[model samples]
Target: MEIKTIGVVGAGKMGNGIALSAAMAGYQVVLQNRTAANLVKAKNSMENQLQKLVQKNVVTAEESAATMARVQMTSTFEKFDAVDFVIEVVAESLDLKTAMFIQLDTMCKKEAILVSSTSTFSITALAAVTQRPPQVAGMHFFIPPTKLVELTRGYYTSDETVNQAKAVAKQMDRVCVEVKKDSPGFIANRIYTPLFLEAFKAYEEGLASKEDIDLAMKSSYLPIGPFELADIIGLDVLKSSLEYYQSELGPSWSPPLSLKQLIRAGRLGKKVGKGWYDY
Candidate 1:
């Protein structure tokens, strides 16, 4: 099916980025969040991001305004009934995402494709909750949304669904890598999670300070240090991903002690102004 209108759930970092990209790509976008305040914040955030793009000459002011105009922000899922595609970017909780998928399946048009921006969760498991399992897939976008988007297929996801999802990612100007199997973490996270585990373990074992480790890695080949990246991604998110990995991968994937301690103290990440590093 041709995708003309897109629905994005969870107006947080990932959600807003996805909505903005779709709007810029000339698709009518419906960005939904449960909280009105979050919807406001997301709208303002998109405006600011578009302004930055304008300043950098990545997009013209007229284009940016037009992109912003294409997006419709809402607090209700009812608005998604007519959307041709729905991307769920909610928290990485299995229960939360599964529930949302069930709701989307009930409310969205039967032909609408449902996708998730999940990093580590199983797309097949989520598809199981919906009647249109063949239409459910994973479209995992990175933090910034400029990098690669991993397209994953659930056991029942059809070839047409994968092609349609790839089309959406390409329209958003993102490179796509297809994961043929229904696996936890797919491609990027499957490899990156182990690196995160080692980094956390090193810090916990006093092998090196996070700063030193970050500097060492950045000075070498990485654009950003693992710890810094973790903080930016949210320690809570990191811990949750780790827990999921441990359950699916092995005990070695368990979150480090220091990581858990920081989360217990409520230092999530940059959004909260504190994490492994202060903001």
Candidate 2:
């Protein structure tokens, strides 16, 4: 679709990180949030991430500032009307995302591609809300956007959007992988959920400590164990998604009781300073 500028909806961690990544890839970025405070935080977060890139010599200081400059944060969704693509990065709620897509469908140009970052919802339901099924698709990015190297394609996503999203992913230096369906959690989650659930089960059954399980994963060549990654992704977010998956997939994927209790106590991983490990 020849995307030049992208509209990122939501200023939470994923939205802000996606905007920063797109800006670093040399695209003009427009990011929006419903609240002014979140918008400000998103901007600051982008700046801080750019600074880290400069520190690591991945991006020059001038380049980092200019990349940071390319990103504009707004509280107005109306500004995204002209963007070539609208990636809905809002929280993981089907109703909220569908409503935003319906609004974007009315506000954006007909040709503007709509992509959802939803991890569990079916794209078919979201596409039904927009009346642009061919133009609507999934463009899931792994957490910690800087190192994103995998993406999932929805069942109805057009080959054109897949090609376009792959182009964008390449620009971000990601290793793009296609999924045949928008199945709950797509391929990565489909494969990893069992392992994660097993780990949680073991912990709940008092089979082993969290640290030992994590060490096993690291020793076995996995970058980090599920619990460790869940901590980074926020335990609350993971817990919520687990509940969603359990409802959608049944008992085998259900979140263990320990994880639920941990989230209720507010220990949501590295961002909150306590989870499976000390931050």
Candidate 3:
């Protein structure tokens, strides 16, 4: 099916970023969140990012304005009926995401494609909860979706659905990597999550300071070190994802005790002004 207009659920970081990318690609975008305040924040954040693109000469002023005009924010999911595609970009919780998929499966047109932006879970489990398993797949976007994305076809996902998702990603100027087989963490995270866990382990064991380990990695091949990225990802989120991985992959992916304590202390991450380090 042709995807012209797109609906994005959740107005958090990933949701807003996806909306911005889709709008810049000339798609009519409807960004949805459960709260009005988040919808406002998402709208303002997109405008700020668009203004930056204008200032950087990436997009003309007129182009930026037009892109902004193409995006609309709402708290209701029913407004997405006209959209040709819908992408769920909520938190990393499996139950919550599954509920969203089930709801979207019922709400969206039978022909309208549905996908998830989950970075931790397999699309198979999510698709199993929906009636349109053939049209459901995982479209995992990197932090900034303009760069890279992963398209994972669920066990029952059709080739047509994968091709349509790839086409949509291309239109958004994103390079799509197909995960031929469904893996626990997909491609990128399967490699990186373990390393981040090890980093936490080292710090927890007092092998090195968090700063020292971060410095060591940054001094080598990585852009942002694990702890910093953990803060950016939110420690609670990191802890929860690790717990999920540990359940599936064994102790190697075990959530660090110190990390759990930090989360228990209510220091989430950069969004809350503190985590591994003060933000």
Q: Provide the overall lDDT of each model, using Cα atoms, as 2-decimal numbers.
A: 0.91, 0.81, 0.89
Record all residue pairs in model 3 with backbone atoms less than 3 Å apart, i.e. clashing: none
Off by over 4 Å in 3: 144-146
Report lDDT (Cα) of residue 170, candidate 2. Answer: 91
Tell me the tens digit of each residue's lDDT in model 1 across 123-227. 999999999999999999998445699999999999999999999998888999999987878988888888888888888899999999999989998888898
The better candidate by TM-score, 2 or 3, is 3
Query: Per-residue alpha-carbon lDDT of model 2 for 16-130, expressed as tens digits?
Result: 8888888888899999888999988988888888788789998899998899788877888777777998888988877788898899989898888888888777777788787
Error of 1 at 208 (Å): 1.5
Pick by TM-score: 1 or 2, better one: 1
| Model 1 residue 100 lDDT score | 96
Where is model 1 more than 4 Å wrong at Cα? none
What are the RMSDs of all candidates, in order? Answer: 1.3, 2.1, 1.2
* Candidate 1: 10-residue stretch with minimal lDDT: 139-148
Ordered list by lDDT, greatest first: 1, 3, 2
**Candidate numbers, best TM-score first, in rank order:** 3, 1, 2
Model 2 CA lDDT for position 160: 83
> Top TM-score: which candidate number?
3
* Candidate 2 residue runs with Cα over 4 Å from true position: 146-151, 277-279
lDDT of 2 at 152: 51
